[model samples]
Target: MTGNAFTAVIDDTMTAPNIGEPEEDMFRLARHLGLDIQGFHTFGDAAEFPQLQREAWDAARTALDRGLPVFAKELDLGNETSLIYAYDADGYYTHSWHGGKGHEGSDAVIPWTELGRNYCPCSSCRARASSGDRPSDGVYTGDPGYGGFVSLHWASAAEPSDARRALGAALDFALSFSRRGAYGWGGRTFYSGPAAYGKWIGLLRSNAIQSFYMGYFIDLFHESRLYAYRFLLEASEHFDGRPGDELRTAAEHYGVIAKNFQSLNKLFPWMQPHAPIDDPDRRREAVELLTGIRQLEEEGWGLLERLLTWVR
Candidate 1:
């Protein structure tokens, strides 16, 4: 699916409040698409770990036997999704977020026993079809819409008021960063919204952030801005005409921001685990790029404000 379609269905606003948390996003999308997701039992300590692993294994085996991929989290790693594609008497073979350099299924092999140790307190399982309605092969045969996927084509024809509401939601989500409360794993305060840009700038100037973390922020914001650009472009379509000029302008500015983020990603290349961390020259260059990004983001926010005026 196009990013626009996916984000629209997933209801992503490309803002800090929702970014950096895939579990929430996955469940949101699943709910929007009408999938029923169930949380697994969370174990608090090593004593309870075996029960958690057993339950997860049973769920995974059930799903795999039906030719369905099992969704797992926190297996031999922390805070990422893993897809169990195959399993045997030894363990479950997964395609995880932490897989080594290779084709998807070539590496990630977590033994069942290992899962008891590395698995986090929380895990989940989901099935495609509802209870008795499930097919013999577990494949969904009915219309996908019945399974909860909203039709974006129909959404594109949304009324002006509905479109305006959506635009307003986007604006609110953007502004939330500055006002967002401490809401991250372990109560960490995230500098969100416009403040996030400033936070990165401060970190760069102080040389406080490690290379991997810096790279991760760059990658995350890059993806976020890219999504923002696409969302603005799609949103602009709803405002076609004289009133839409502001929307188009906003989209253009967001496109520039997206490009700037792309450049930053190239400079940092955070996806590489062994990327350099404490290079003064690279840090200086990043500061310059961030300054430019901050300016572009402010300009985009200004345009968004104008667009909101029209919509309001």
Candidate 2:
């Protein structure tokens, strides 16, 4: 029940930065929730590949041996985060989306040397992923240097993650993140906060929607706002009187936000990212939903900013 919903992020392409980038915000969410994140993330330069593998190997081994779970990004099937549960001499064992696809559990060990390899080694996975609409599928050219790895483990909170305290911080984040042109993307080709909505809408109206990533945006936003609605409802009950009332009202805003995305998801009908949306009516409807969401979120920012002053 951490307040990460406050950190929802979207980019110009409608993918890549969802909830995971803007790294400092994630650290903020973890901090207020009283947890410490351990491990490292690195781009695999050829010279650093061996060191990256060794570091990840050591960390994963330590965590897994203690019966604690280990997690990694893109362990198999590009863009699919997975669990690093156990290990053996050959490599680290994993249970990710691939296991269900016939790889089976620990048997699908990713050799330690390939720890951060971006693409899949399997011919079928490579073939399908490369040809599919999934932009996350990086080509595994068998070069360790070209890969990237995100290895993570959790440690006990350094301080108390009081929900009451975190609420104030969350509301503060919601207000700040909503302001247009406030956060910088370091010259990267991306957008954040309310400006992101405008970028997304402008693309759709111009019939320039990248169908796969557009579907990705809708789906991710839909799920995040649903959680925001639920988290606020839960957080409301944790406090009393005006603070609680404000939170409940905040929940209502997110509830509407969630429903907005729900409508957008449907209007882009059939929910299949691979399928192109050719119907002009559906496109117009999607634009309306996005515009409505932008307005609704503006209201939410106001409500949350007010709540921020009194949360503690």
Candidate 3:
């Protein structure tokens, strides 16, 4: 997902100046995107001198002139995602999410983190974990070196040794925050309520994922047949004594329902505002699409009811 992108201050009074080269890129983009950029950093005669920071800042300003208001942080933190931030040249932040409380700006958690974890060891996590204290959420906020407002997002934990477990945990974390209306990916815009649910439906259709698995009537029937047998066995034996513990069965059952309702999911991708459906006619198209889904849902639910009665 594109993750959440925002502009953050290093502190109460900090503005863009205190940000190093890497951070300057975010500032530059904010300027390009016509966002407010206000932040400060302390710089003086240290061994690193002003050259490195100056070069980075200068380059960032150039990008700002070009109007690209987002940039990734160059720091290496041990997380599964890349960190990016945005700057508002005016330093005045406004986001639909906060309901006008205004944003100081925040970091962008890129999907690339998952990719990055495939290679390196996450240093931030190591340091935090080594302290013999349970770390707060993976979120790294305001390092002392950068003063208070410079927050960092640790790439999720995905190491070779326990990559599977780490990936699962990280995905869970991402999903938790994402569902709060903080992330978007694969050209899909997700929001609250049925908006996200509707987006998933559209995504399933436009991506042609169903064509690969749920296209043919026979294939769906076979799947349902297999699931029915399994479901019956589960019901009879009560594996783990759980309802729907047999995911293979439940998925197949749901998959059948989803396919039978394919037309419902299919209509939205073309109508919803989330997908590549960016024409000015968005609302009208969506309304028509919603009509179709409504019809299909009514019909689909009926089918589900019948199927449920017969299966059990």
Candidate 4:
């Protein structure tokens, strides 16, 4: 029989889109994990909330009954994804990044009514019900690749023009949000790219940002720099002679930036937006670290520009 609940490790990349839209990464992760996604659904307004709640409840119960967990979004929390693992007469048990009450990774109770009020339509998954067998453990362990190295390999094998185009696309993606402005989906504003970084830096300098948001930015840029380093490394392999040497040097610089981001993340251990950073000394230290990071990123942009001239 299915137990009271099931919980699995949530991949941060799956829940947080450090780059691109959240759902883009979510769907990519689901597919990479071989999940048979039943697609996402939404419910709004008080009248529709009850009906949607019933549908969601039934969906959660059905999946849990079969020993599978469901993905839920917008649970009065940061629009991040949460896993619904079990349900009973009163409410559902969930695990999320902010698992309510500073209890990330632990089960948190949410009354059905409360869930209904804050719920947005989300994807649900199941095992091989047709075969009456549970899904493979590998389902939860699918490889997402080593920093997109697979794409790098494919780009390398293509023509030089093709590789140049790929690099151009990568550069465009890197600079997508360097300037500040409102960006979002369906008219809901969400900070993104360099703008997101700028906003966080502004808040941090003013001592108005929470520790959680600080941690979030640290994780975001850490991952971003890591990916940038990997892409540059792979791009370096495609060139030859002087150009190749230059690319390798640029890759090395990005690697340093990536390591710096890792160090920055260590400064803030918690991941709560409302968690305070009241010490003036600590705030100054954070500002200095961010300034250094921005400087390194500017250097990276300059290096990339030089590389593009050679490739084009």
Best by TM-score: 2
Q: Cα lDDT for residue 193, model 4?
A: 36
Candidate 4, residue 91: the lDDT equals: 75
What is candidate 2's lDDT per residue for 1-312, written digit by digit as tens? Answer: 334564446655544544335454555567776666666654565666678778878888887777665777656655456677788997776665553454324245677776655444444555655786342453232344454554445344478567777777766666565564434342335555677788888878877765677777788888888999998898888889999899899899999999988988876543455545577787788888899998887787777778887775
Per-candidate Cα lDDT values, in order, are 0.52, 0.66, 0.31, 0.52
Ranking by TM-score: 2, 1, 4, 3
Give one digit per residue, the lDDT tens place, for model 1 in 148-184. 1000000111122355655565464444433442344
Residues 69-118, model 4: lDDT tens digits: 47665442324456676678877776655334433334545676554233
**Using Cα atoms with residue i matched to residue i, what is each candidate's TM-score against the true structure?**
0.58, 0.83, 0.22, 0.51
Distance from true location, Cα of 229 in model 3, Å: 17
Cα lDDT for residue 232, model 3? 35
Please list the residue runs of candidate 3 whose C-alpha ends up more than 4 Å from where it truly belongs after superposition: 1-190, 195-239, 245-253, 256-312
RMSD of each candidate relative to the true structure: 12.5, 3.7, 20.5, 13.8
Q: Which stretches of candidate 1 lie over 4 Å from their true place?
A: 1-22, 33-43, 46-49, 62-68, 76-80, 88-90, 96-109, 116-178, 187-189, 238-247, 265-282, 298-312
- Candidate 2's C-alpha runs over 4 A off are 15-20, 101-106, 119-147, 155-159, 179-188, 273-276
Residue lDDT tens for model 3, 1-312: 111111111111111112212233343333323344443222323333234344444444454455544232222232122323333332111111212223222222213222111111234334455875432222223332332122222111122323223222322332333234323321223342233334434444454223222123223223433443343334434233332343234434434444544443353332223234333354344345544543443343343333333323
Instruction: Judging by lDDT, tell me the better candidate of 2 and 3.
Output: 2
